[model samples]
Target: MTDKIYNVLFLCTGNSARSIIAEALLNRAGKGRFRAYSAGSQPKGEVHPYTLDLLRSLNYDISDARSKSWVEFSADGAPQMDFVFTVCDSAAAESCPIWPGHPITAHWGVPDPAAAEGSESEKRLAFADAHRMLGNRVNAFVSLPLASLDRLTTEGRVREIGRSLSEAG
Candidate 1:
């Protein structure tokens, strides 16, 4: 396997939940193989409380997690991403900045747990479900033999992972 580490970016309308969960999942699952970052087109400016709670419960380090703008990734000297995935339908529909390396992009839209309305337990369940769905997708992504695949094949595989999971349930 190649020693190179890949950079990945996850986007959403709000930087509060789904994208943040995705970032955490990929960072943990991909570990030495991939570095993950997240941002929003219209950031909420703060992460959702439940998001932090869920991650904390899962033993994830959230000390450095905060909602940020996608503009940060587009800035000069920003890390060039190998892949970019939009986890929200709204974000997928919006105009995105030109990524430095022309990274392969995909839509891995997940239902907004933050939008779930009901009892506290129900709301938390939404967050859990979102996390589970993203975990499956992230696992599929990290399993790919990226070093042996051509860029086109890698792109196709990533897109398929998103597409297949989005259709699940």
Candidate 2:
């Protein structure tokens, strides 16, 4: 497994917002050591407009992002996940696919900023806050000492990272 990059999937009830944000943040931060992807158990088929707006403001490519099902990853020849995280409180409780690799999993449990019912400005703020929190956790994850620990990826260290990342979020 030399030079293998970790594949991380972010899951949510709706792939429109939180999962999208986590995907972009982790991919951007990981560069080469991590590969970030996202999907939902129940996809909305379209990303929330605000998700695109905020990501574009950050100079991220939102054009190719769309809501998709977790089943897409359950197929043959699917990219084996090294880690999986549920980014929304709803998804954390929902039934999930049996990821093939048995990759380390965790729950970040970010509230649905999309469900925030209020002024447009308030909704925007909620999205931004979720973005900030997820970004912080991803930063912590990428900086972990994965290279030094012996048989680290196979050990319980992965679970620790997941738990630590979640609590910090």
- Winner by TM-score: 1
- Go through the candidates in order and give each one's C-alpha lDDT: 0.95, 0.85
Tens-digit lDDT track for model 1 on 74-156?
99999999999999999999999999989999989899999999999999999999999999999999999999999999989
Cα miss at 156, model 1 (Å)? 1.0
TM-score for every candidate vs. truth? Answer: 0.98, 0.89
RMSD from true fold, candidate 2: 2.2
lDDT of 2: 0.85
Per-model tally of clashing residue pairs: 0, 0
> Model 1, residue 91: what's the lDDT?
100
> lDDT at 10 for candidate 2?
95
